[model samples]
Structure formats: C-alpha cells, structure tokens
Target: MESKRVLITGAAGFLGSHLCDLFIKKGYEVVGMDNLITGDLSNIAHLFKLKNFEFYNHDVSKFVHISGKLDYILHFASPASPIDYLKIPIQTLKVGSLGIHNLLGLAKSKNARILIASTSEVYGDPSVNPQPESYWGNVNPVGPRGVYDEAKRFQEAITMAYHTFHGLETRIVRIFNTYGPRMRLNDGRVLPAFIGQALRGEDLTIFGDGSQTRSFCYVEDLIEGIYKLLLSDYAFPVNIGNPDEITIGQFAEEIIELTGTDQKVVYKDLPQDDPKQRRPDILKAKELLNWEPKITRAEGLKLTYEYFKSLTKEQLEKIDHKDFSEFTR
Candidate 1:
C-alpha cells in the first residue's frame, strides 16, 4: 500500500520542522515547503536524506503546485513573531490571506484534510483572562501588531467559510506560547529572548513592568495536540497550550535561576497594543482532543536551556541584546 502524503508549509521553521518530523515518522510522504524568509533550513536538514521526505523552496502566498495524491495539508507558512511580522508586515498579511487561500483551494481540489495554525494573537490583547475560542477579541487593526493579528483572524474566517460552503475538512488550532529546541535564539519572543540574554551574561530585558501574564506549552506536547486534532472529526478552533500562567517578572526570575547566569531583569517601555494578560481556556481541547501538556515548565525549561547551551559559540555570538517584546503564542 502507498503511504499517505502531507504538505507542510513553513517546514523549515521551528514548529513546521517538527511537524515534518512527526508526519515522516508516521510513514507519510512528507512534502515540505518554505520560502526561507524567516525559516531556517537547518531545522529540517536532518530529513533531507529520507525517501519519504521532500521539500520545495516556495512561498504559499504565490501559486502552489504539488504533484501526486495529497491526503493532508498543514498550513503554517506565515511570519509568526512580532520582530518578523513587524519587519515584513506586507508579507505577513499576504501569507495569512493569500497563502491560506491557495492552500485551502488546493486542499479542496485534492480532497485533503487541512489544518491551519491559528494563534492566541487572534484574541488581541484579550480583555478576558484565559481566553476561550468564542471570544470575539479586542484588536487594533491599525496598530503595529495588527498585521499579524488581523491576518490570523481572517485566516480563521475564511477557513470556516470553506468548511461550511464547500464541505471542506478543516481543523484550526489556536496555539498559545510554545518553547523548545530549534527555536531561533533571537526570534524576539519572550522565552528565547530571555534565555539568549541570560546566556550572553546580559540583563534580561522585559518591556513594561513585567507584570503581564503568559502561559507556555512546550513544543512536544503541542505537536501531540496538533496530531490528534488533525485526525479528530472536529471543525472548530481548539486551544492547545499549558495553562499554568506566570507573570513576566516571575518568568524572568525563573530564567535567571535556570540559566545560572548573574543577569538581572531590566524593564523598558512596552510596545503599543502588547497584551497585559494572555492565557488560553483549553477546556474545549481537553474534551475534544483528549489532550493537555505533559511537560512541566520546570522540566521543559531545563531541556530548552540544555539545547540553547549546546549551541556553538558562533551561534551564541549571533545573539545581540534587543527589545524583548513578548508575542503571546
């Protein structure tokens, strides 16, 4: 029998690369795609030699063409971090808009199940603590973070449209903060930024008073949730993340202790529209997907620190102190 095939966009990225690994391990013919804009090839370099794994250096915002039968498509091609989306807002908007359009059409044509990576950012600076999937969100479409936020919001809308009007098989996972190996040290997210600063013997930078709250779900547990959601007969968005929330000030202190670096926490002006509180109400995910994070923050942090510490000195030197703005998932 022929193996199933999956097309994972942004496969060179941290999460996308891990998804590629999962599908390949399941004996699927994995077709990975990325334009290498913010994604690093090294993340998926180990899979290049596998017969079941192939890749295309292409952007989903443009035309996407794949040969042969495709059973699944995981759309994860957008610029995720604030540093990335802020730098290339146009491209960021394009992927969440044009990119998902192409993938959805392709999924329809191929009769493939499609899963999109929506985000907690969709609930922009959420008013309610522990945001649920039903919240309409409080977003500033013209704000600096709007490019990424609105794009994801639109992605979810269009995805639901396809599922309703066209009878497409669709799954949406609103990912919360996730940290692990393969994360770019300078991606500008709070976790890596704090770790990078600590590793460099520099003060950990926190925008605002460091009182804003965030919940982190380790990458491995996140991947399991995604995998289960893909196979489940669900069509609505599900929140997948750890709900053990912590304040930024508290998290910075935790990082300092974990890294064993003599760096103190420093504060700066928070960027406009940065959420003061962000956490997910994941009851839906638990009831629907039967999933919750298995890794504790302490265990996950130790593993993540070891990965960052194992980086070559050259890799470590590439990290420079900058604004450590937190993008909650």
Candidate 2:
C-alpha cells in the first residue's frame, strides 16, 4: 500500500512541529508549511534531515499551491497567542478566514481529509462550566480580543459550510490551554509567563487576584487527541483538553515549586476581557475518540521545565524580559 501524504500549515509551530514528528514516525510523507510569522524554524530544524519530511516557507494567508494529490491537510496556521494576534491582528484574521478557505479549496480539489485547529476561545468568557460543543459562546463582537476569537468562530462556520455544501471531509478540534516542550518561552500565555518569571528570579505576576481558573492539557496528550480526531468519522467541533481545573494562583505556586525558585507572588490588574474560568468538557472526545489526557499537570510541568532549562543563557534572558502588554492591545 502507498503511504499517506499529509500537509500541515504552521508545521513549525509547537503543536504543528510535534504533529509532523508524529506523522513522520508513522512513515507518512509529511509536508510542513509555515510563514515563520511567530513559528520558529528551530522547532522543526531537526526534522529537515528526515527523509519523509518536506517544508515550505509560505504564508497560508496568501495563496497556497501544491502539486500532486494530498491525503490530508491540517490547517493550523494562525497567531494563537493574544500577544501575537494583538500585534498582528490583520494577519490573524486573514489566516483564519482566507487561509482556511484556500486550504479547503485545496482539500476539495484533492479529495483529501482536512482538519482545522480551532480554539476554546471561541467560547469567549463562556457562561457554561465544563463547556460542551453544544453551547453557543458568549463572545463580545467588538472587544479587543474579538479579532482572534471571532476569526476562529468564523473559521469554524466556513469549515462547516464547506463540509455541508461542498461535501468535503472536515474536522475541527477546539483546543484548550496546551503546553509542553518546544513552546516559545515568550509566547505570553499564562504557563510560559509564570515559568519565565520564576526562571528569571522575578516576582510571579498574578492578574485579578489569581482566582481565574483554567484547565491545561499537556502537549503530548493534545497531539494524541488531535490525531485521533483526524482519523475519526466525526465532523463537528470536539473539545480536546484536560478537564482538571486549577486557579492561576495555585498554578503559579506549582511553577515556583517545580522550578525550585524563591520568587514571591505579585498581583496585577487583569487585562480586559480576560476569561475568569475555562475548562473543556471532553465527553464528546471520550465517547467519539476514546481519548483522555495521560500526562498529569505535575509530570507535564516537570518536562516543560527541563526543556526551558536546556535553553542557553541568552535565550533564557530574552524570554525573561519578554513584554506581555503588547498582547493586550
């Protein structure tokens, strides 16, 4: 039998790069595309030497053209972090809208299965606890964070349209907070922020009294769920994340202990539109994909700490001073 050919946008990203590694290990011919807008080449630099791996430094927001028939297309190219999207809001919106449309067109041409990487942020400041896929989000249309959230919401809408109108095979995975090795230390997400602060011997900054809660899924577990969803027969968006909730304050303390740092807690005003709580109910994932997160928070954090420790002193310094205020604008 012939090997499957998989095309992944944002293939150099934390999750995308890991997906490439997994596909290559499974003997699939993998093509990774990234504009390197926020994705670092260093993440997939090692994979360049792999015989089954190929890469394209192209922006998915623009046109994407490829030869031959593709068996799969994973459209994951977009600015995921608030800091990134805030700085490049136009690009964020374009990738989710135009980029997804282009990829869907390509998938239709090749009769290939396509999976879009959606986000739990689609449920903006959601009212429901342990949010299921059935709940319509409580999103603010004109909020500062709306650029990214609404773009994803529109992405899902168009994806479903393609599936229903064009008869395209499509899958959408609503990713929650995911962290692990290869994550950009300066991404400005909560995990990296806390970890970077502790590593730099600075005060751990907690916003809004540190009472806001989030459920984190280790990268490995997230990747496993993504792979399962891609192969499953389901088409609607499914939540894939760990359901164990922890307060931001408690999470910061966990980082301090894990990093063996003596950093003290410092409170700051929470950013506008910051969600007070987030936890995905993965009953659909469990029932359809038979998936659950395997790596506990402690185990995932330790592994991530080791990866952060392996960075050179200069890289660590850069991450230490990374400005997060830009993400809010």
Candidate 3:
C-alpha cells in the first residue's frame, strides 16, 4: 500500500510535534508547517533527520501552498497558551479564522481530509459540569481571553460550513487542557506554571483559592484521540481529554512532590473570567474511538518532570519567570 501524505500545521508545537512524530512512525510522509510564533522548532528538530518528515517555516494565516498528493491536513495552528494568544491576539484570531479558511481550501483542492484543533475554551466559563458537545458555551465576547475563545468558536463554525456547503471532509476536536513533554514552559498555563515554580523553588501561585477544577490530557493520549477522529466517520465535534479531574491546589501539590521542592503555596488573585470548573464528557470518544487516557496523572507528571529536569540551567530560568502580558490582544 502507498504511504499517506499528511500535512500538519503548527508542526513544531507541543501537540503538533507529537502528531508529526506519530504520523512518521506510522509510515506516512509528514509535512510540518509553522511560523515559530509560539511553537519552537527545537521540539521537532530531531524529526528533520527522518526520511519521511519535512518542515516548512510558514504561517498558515497568510496563505498555504503545498505540493504532492495530500491525504490529510491537520490544522493545529494558532497560539493556544494564555501568554501566547494574549501576546499575539491578532495572529490568534487570524489563524483560527483566515488560517482555517485557507487550509479548508487546500483540503478541497487536494481532496484531503482536514482536522481542526479546536478548544474546550469554546465553553467559556462553562455552566455545565462535565461539558457535553450539546452544551452551547457561555463565552464573554469582550473579555481578555475573548480573542482566543471566540476565534476557536468561529473556527468551528467555519469548519462545519465547509463540511456542509462545500462537501469537504472535516473533523473538529475540542481539546481540553493537554500537558506533556515539550510543552513550552513559559506558556502561562497551569501545569507548566506549577511545575516551573516547583522546579525553580518558587512559591506556587494559586488563583482564587485554587478551587477551580480541570481535566488534563497527556499529549500522547491527545494525539491518539486526534488520529482516531481524523479517520472516523463522525462529523460533529468530539471532546478529547482525560475525564480525571483535579483542583488547581491539588495539582500544585503534585508538582511540589515531583520536584521535591519545599516551596510554599501562595494565593493570588484569579485572572478575570477563569472557569470555576472544567471537565469533558468523553462518552463520545469512548464509544466512538474506543479510547481512554492510559497514562494516569501521576505517571504523566513524572514523565513531564523528567523532561523538565533535563533542561539546562538557562532553560530552567526561562520557565521560571514567564510573562503573561503578551497573551492578550
């Protein structure tokens, strides 16, 4: 059988790089594209030596032009981190709206199936407990995080439009909080925040009593779920995340244990519009993809700690003091 040609946007990112690695291992020809906006090339630098892997330093928001018979296009572009999207708010919106449009066009031209990396943020400060796909989100349009949340919402709308109007093969996966090795330490997300602080012997900052709950999916599990969705016949959006829930304070404690740090926990003002509770109802993923996260939080956190510990002193410092101001538009 001929090898499938796969194109992945944001190919150098935490999740994107992992997807690229998986595709290459599956005997597929992989093409990766990124602008180095929030994604670091170092994440996938090793893949350049692979015969079936290719990298392109291009931003998808402008225009995407690719050759060869493309079988699949995974649009995982856009700045996902709070610190990132806040810094490049315009780019975040552009990538979700225009970038997705461009990729859908390419998918139509190449007759390739397209999968978009949407987010659980679509359920902005969600009122639902375990959010189901049927729940219409309650997002703030003019809030600080609106740029990213609304962009993802718009991306999903446009994807479905292309699927129905143009008859293009499209898949949307609403990814929840995902963490693993290669995640940018300065991304301002909770997992890295806790881990970085603990590693550096800094006080772990908890916002709003650290009562907010979240479900974290390991990168490997997330990648597998995405792969299954792309190949599956389901058209509607499916949630892909570990249903295991943890409070922010508990998560901080876990990091402290892993890092063996004696640093104390510090309470800080919660960011505006922070969700009180966020977890996915993965019944669809379980029934359709026959997938559940195999790696428990303990196991996943240990693996992540090993990766973070391997970084140089300078790299460790970079993760210690991350600036989140840039994440806003």
Candidate 4:
C-alpha cells in the first residue's frame, strides 16, 4: 500500500514540528513548509534525514502550490505569541487571511482534508469560565491583540465557508495553552517566561494580580487530539486542551517548586485584552473524539524543565529581558 502524503505549514514551529513527527510516525509522507519567520529550523532538523520527509522554504500567504496528490494539510503558519504578533502584526494578519485562503483552495484542488490551527484567544477575555465553541467571543478589533485574534476569527469563518459553499473538507481546532519541549524560552508565554526566569535565577514575572487562570495541555496530548479530529467525520470547530485550571500566581509557585529554585513573584500591569480566564469546555472533544489530556502538569513540567536545563549557559542567557507588558496571558 502507498503511504499517505500530508502538507504541514509552519513545519518548523513548536506545534507544527510535533505534528510532522506524529504523521511521519503514522507512515505518512510529510511535506513540511515554513517561512522561518517565527519558526526555527532546528526543530525539524532531525526529520530532514528521513526518506519520507521533504521541506519547502516558502511563505503560504503569497501562493501555495503542492505537486502530486495530497491527502491532508495542516495550516499552523502564524505568529502565535504576543511577542511575535506585536512585533510583526501585518504578517500575522496576512497568514490568517491570505495564507488560509490559499490553502483552502489548494485543498479544494487536491481534494484533500485540511485542518486549521486556531487559538483560544478567539474567546477574548471570555465572560464564561469554561469557554465552549458556541460562545461568540468578545473581541476588540482595534485592540493590541486584535491583529492575531481577528485574523484567527477570519480563518475560522472562511474555513466554514469553504466547507459549506465549496464543500471543502475542513477541520478547525481551537488550541488552548499547550506546553512541552521545543518551546522558545523568550516567547512571552507564561510557561516559557516563568521557566526561563527560574533557569536564570531571576524573579518570575506575573502581568496581573495573579487571579487570571489558564489551562495547559501537553504537546503530545494535543497532537493526539488533533490527529483524531482530522480523521473523524465531524467538521465544526472543537476545543483541545486540559481542563485542569490554575491561576497565574499559583502556577508561578508551582514553577518555583518544580525548578527547585527560590524565586519571588513580581506583579506588573496586565496587558489590555489579555484573557482573565481561559479553560476550554472540552465536552465536544470528549463526546466526539474521545480525547482528553492524560499527562499531568507535574509530569509535563518536569520534562520541560529538564529540556531547558540541558541547554547551555549561552542558551539560558539568550532569554533576554524585553518589555513583556503584552505577554500572552
């Protein structure tokens, strides 16, 4: 039997790289693509040696072209972190808009199933405790985080349109706070920022009073959920994340214990539009895909901490001090 072929955008990113690994493990011929803007080539360096893996150094926002038949396409090409989107706001918008449009058309032409990588930020500062897919969301289009949030919102809309109007096979996964190996230390996310600070023997910085809550799903668990969703017949957006919620302050303390380093928590002003509470109501995912995170925060954090510790002192120092007033809380 011939192997399935999958084209994954953002192939060098944290999540995209993992998805590539998963598909390759499942006997799929993987064609990885990335612009290398926020993506690091080091993440997918090991895959280059495999016979079934091929990579393209191209941006999807311009035009996407895939030779031969394609069985699947996973669109994960975007600046996900606040540090990234705030720095390159225009590119973020373009990828969510033009990039997705190009890929949907490509999927249509190849008659392939395409899955989009959406974010929990779509439920901006959500009023509900555990956000479900039915929530319309409260987003400020002109806010600082608007560029990325609105871009994802547009991605979801166009994807569904392609499903209904063009009859394209599309799957949307609204990813929550996911953490694991290969994560950038200075990406301005709470997990990496806290871990990087603890590694550097610096104080952990909390943007708010520490009342804000977030649920984190491990990378392996998230990748499994994504794969299951792709193969399932359902097409609507589904949330994939751990439901075990913890406040930013409480999480900081947990980091201190995990790192075995004594660090004080420092408070700062919270960024505008930063979600105060972020826990996914994964009932749909559970009932539909039979998916829920199996790895505990303790287990995942230990593995991640070890990965960070293995880095050289130079790598630790690379976590430079930048203005994190707009962190992805």
Top candidate on lDDT is 4
lDDT of 1 by residue, 1-329 (tens): 98899999999988999999999888899999998887778789999999899999998998899988999999999889888888788888999999999999999999999999999999999889989999989999999999999999999999999999999999999999999998887677999999888887889999999999999999999999999999999999999999999999999999988987788777999999999998999899899989989999999999999998998987665433223243222
Clashing pairs in 3: 85-327, 86-326, 86-327, 86-328, 87-326, 87-327
Candidate 4 segments whose C-alpha is farther than 4 A from its true place: 316-329
Which wins on lDDT, candidate 2 or candidate 4? Answer: 4
The superposed Cα distance between candidate 3 and the true structure at residue 27, in angstroms, equals 0.5
Kindly provide the TM-score of model 3 when superposed on the true structure, using C-alpha atoms: 0.96
- Assess each prediction's global lDDT (C-alpha) against the native: 0.91, 0.90, 0.89, 0.93
lDDT of 4 at 244: 98
Cand. 2 TM to true fold: 0.96
lDDT against true structure, model 4:
0.93
Cα deviation at 201, candidate 2, in Å, is 0.5
Per-residue accuracy of model 4 over 93-120 as CA lDDT, tens digit each: 9999999999999999999999999999
- TM-scores of all candidate predictions against the true structure: 0.96, 0.96, 0.96, 0.96
Error of 1 at 187 (Å): 1.6
The per-prediction tally of clashing pairs is 0, 1, 6, 0
Q: Please write out the lDDT profile of model 2 over residues 1-329, one tens digit for every residue.
A: 89999999999888999999889988999999998777778889999998888899998877789998799999889888887888778888899999998999999999999999999999999898988999898888788889999999999999999999999999999999999987776576999888877777889888899999999999999999999999999999999999999999999889988988788999989988888889999999999999999999999999999999889998766544434343332
